[model samples]
Target: MALRTRAVLVHRRTELDELLDRHATRGQAEFFLRTRGRTLADVEARHEAATSARSAVAASVPSDWALAEVERTDLDRFLFAPEDVVLVVGQDGLVANVAKYLDRQLVVGVDPEPGTNLGVLVRHDVGDVAEIIGSLAAPRAGAGEGPFSAVRCDELTMVSARLDDGQELRAVNELFLGHPSHQSARYVLGADGGAERQSSSGLIVSTGTGATGWCASIAHDRGGRRLPGPTDRALAWFVREAWPSPVTGVTMTEGVLGRGGELVVTAQSDRLVVFGDGMEADRLEVSWGQEVRVGVAERRLRLL
Candidate 1:
């Protein structure tokens, strides 16, 4: 029997037309276009390239596949198809767009962390909330089917007092604690019972993926030499110069920590912001002697 397959085309419009004209083997396949600026010919060329790539990938599989591009408003329509396999293209934006349309347990091709727009959208849509680094003492069990079945963080470590059953957590490029409004924040950094008070513009904790982006960018601006390892190279280039790094480098699970661990945070500030996977979580007031818990979530993004 011929396997039935469905593919979604996500790219610039000119590219979409070209892909449909060239790679579309049958009329049943769907093509979703995401074109911005380009002439008709340019779009056609892009489509041709994309379609050919898809065909090559599909040929190895046993299932029959169709192709199409999705409209912003019609995501729900495509998502409802239980048998359709949606393929997203482009860079970071592709991951974000794909998450919005996914209601089922579909895999994507990207990293799973807060810094990523896709991670934020997935966390928000699924309703998995993270607390301060010290607050995750026990997993809270509740009724009802969760929006997401699992949450997974790649190349991240968690340090928490305790973790609850079914409440998943993970670390990413880094963890940032600061106020959006420019202000000096005070915090204590240490493991176990020992801690010290330090004041600085802000504090940020980064994993390997976050090293290159905002974290690395800030280091370069401050005249800090590049740190070695895959951890520092991932998102280091994406970091902006305006933001500063954490004052004290408190060692938690340094040197290749796994998915689940804990990083204790105690700080003094009227308002504190916690960023994971590179997105903001609900804000909290960091008072003296108060602890923020951190951990990894169970959901993982399926990247194509």
Candidate 2:
């Protein structure tokens, strides 16, 4: 049997209609309408381009497209088939809205960021994402069994050390430790079995994903001279050798603690900030010897 194909056009109403006129067949294509910003002129401009393109294509093929604005509740109905292709226009925001309602279906994000929309959408919708291109394969099936599974949080320990129980954790491109007070904060950087006492305005750890974010731009001014850790040294070399790094996302899995004793985290004179995935959480303070733990999570984000 031939593969059954369904096309979903997500664009401005005018543009959607034009695309339908050119690429859609009576029984094959459907339109889902979405508008951007507040201005109608932007919508009209997109419509004109779409209509013009459709007019050009219509001369050679029979267009049998059906068009309509996609309703939020009906999104599941449209995505019911695994073979369905969703063609989205506008920015990542629009695509994000559509993805919330879709699951377990093949989604082809058309004209997405760079050459692939798959990675962009996946980063926003799920966590601990690494993009795979070209070939399609079923994701390995297991619970917390992948390369990053060891450090992933399987269960939150109730015993309070530095991090609190029920504190959710996730890894993004970077790990952010910020303060609102505009005064430098003290931190102790450490890895497995290794530790260092350092003072800074704030600290950040950047992953490959967040090599270009704020974590990369902020200067580490404290003169605690020691050979950089593998990742830190590499990032330093990158800054010296390559383009300025960009911030991606912050670490959300670990806990922030106060400096002196075993306190989850308390507000001192200076406000403590911990931000990840472009979102901010409660602010607190850290004293001289506070510890922070950051690591990957156990669960993988599955894309349909």
Candidate 3:
């Protein structure tokens, strides 16, 4: 039997959707916004644009192809198959949100508004989606071309943190090891060169994909560091505000992790946690005496 071709459309909640959720009605939301000198007009327009883009992409799917829609909040619960083609429709962050859950599936990022080039991930317009879908649905598999063979893509490196207990977490951007409440965290940080007991707010290990975010900020604050490119098999890490005391030192603050290299953190506090791409709700809890190793993952994002 031929392999089943599937398309999974991923999206996030719009500002208007959040407003309605909080205020319970458009009238109330409008009233509250009006007091702040803002109208619902802009929010409604963006919401309509996002919805239109999602609908258009959905309509482009071939009737013979199976289709599924996943909201950002449901990514963890959604089960993705190997043959799924992921079309992330939203800002660039939406792409990062879904990247951790995928396993070599081709991704097509759709910009809902499409005017500005703010996104490195969301590169295509809504009109471009139809052609991509058509290309995927064409009868070309017998000629040694797969469903998504016509499109071009780049494989981006990702970061993974494996705990001593065997649990693991991955991120397309960066991984954060810290306390849940942003309080000072205590850990023993180790690398190939050396190790140190640190007391600080937390630590961050960033991929080149994540350098655009917190990693870039940290680099800027520290007079810049040579960050790896998106396709580079490397990672960068930093310890945030490490404290110096009689028992702890602030020597190991930052470094670049090459391919096959690892950064190890042994938790010394009860509430130490690890999260990726700002998704603190989905996190790994490491207790005292537990160790987590950070490294470049073997799996890469196949982005179209």
Candidate 4:
């Protein structure tokens, strides 16, 4: 059978949706917010705008294309197809949330509320989806043009961490390896030709795409370190608050993992967490004496 283009509309639960679910009714939700010195009208207005944007993007999908709507909570259960053209319709973080679950599918980010977000990832508006879909569906190799020349795309690098037991995780932003609580985490960070035992909060292994997020902030606070670009085949890692002591050293705190380089963390604490893009529920657990490897993944988010 010929592959059909599936337009997956990815969204999250709006604040109003959450309030209604928690408070059971709009009046009750309004009353609850009012008690907290916040007005429900503002929430409703934002909700209406988001709902309208989602509806507009949904209507923009090609009529012949198969349509699938997946909430942020249901992404783990949703089966994505190879020919799928994703329409990420939400905040920029939504793009990172969906990237790990995808492969080479062309992702068109539809920013619902413009000017509010940094526009680092979701670069298109609701009006641009129909045209992006048309461009994606149109023929390639026009005259001297190459594949996908009709559509502009960025091949963004991602970070992947693998444990010894065959479990693996990928993230477009960064991979956080830490203790469940905010307590001290014990581990040995191995990267850039050396290894050292350190006791600290945890480690954040990020990519060029993630550089603009958490890693960038860390870089700025630490007097700024160069990070890889979005298309660069590299990954950067930072050891948070590494303490200098008799047994632990802080010199191996932060570094970049070039091409084939990797970050190997040997667990010394009871249990260390490894999650990507803030999805802690769905994550890898590393116990004492176990090893986890973090590096640039072979899969890249082909974002449009």
Rank order (by TM-score, best first): 3, 4, 1, 2
Runs of candidate 1 with Cα error greater than 4 angstroms are: 1-90, 93-106, 109-173, 192-194, 218-261, 277-289, 295-300
Q: After superposition, which runs of candidate 3 have C-alpha atoms over 4 Å from their true positions?
A: 140-151
Q: In candidate 1, how many Å is residue 52 off?
A: 16
Better of 2 and 3 by lDDT: 3
* Cα lDDT listed for each candidate: 0.40, 0.34, 0.90, 0.87
Candidate 4's residue-wise lDDT over 200-291, tens digit each? 98998989889988899999988899989989999888888988889888888888888788988999999999999999988999999999
RMSD (Å) of each candidate, 1 decimal: 14.2, 14.4, 1.9, 2.5
For model 2, how does the per-residue alpha-carbon lDDT over 162-277 read when each residue is reduced to its tens digit? 23333443433433454555364434444434443333445554433343444445333323212122122122111111111242112221222222222122223234455443
In angstroms, how far off is 77's CA in candidate 2? 23
| Minimal lDDT window, size 10, model 2 | 235-244
Provide TM-scores for the models.
0.41, 0.36, 0.95, 0.93
Better of 3 and 4 by TM-score: 3
Please report the TM-score between candidate 2 and the true structure.
Answer: 0.36
- Of 1 and 3, the candidate ahead on lDDT is 3
Error of 2 at 29 (Å): 35
**What TM-score does structure 1 among the candidates reach?**
0.41
Residue pairs clashing in model 4 are: none
Best candidate (score: lDDT): 3
Candidates, ranked, lDDT: 3, 4, 1, 2
Looking at model 3, which ten-residue stretch has the lowest summed lDDT? 141-150
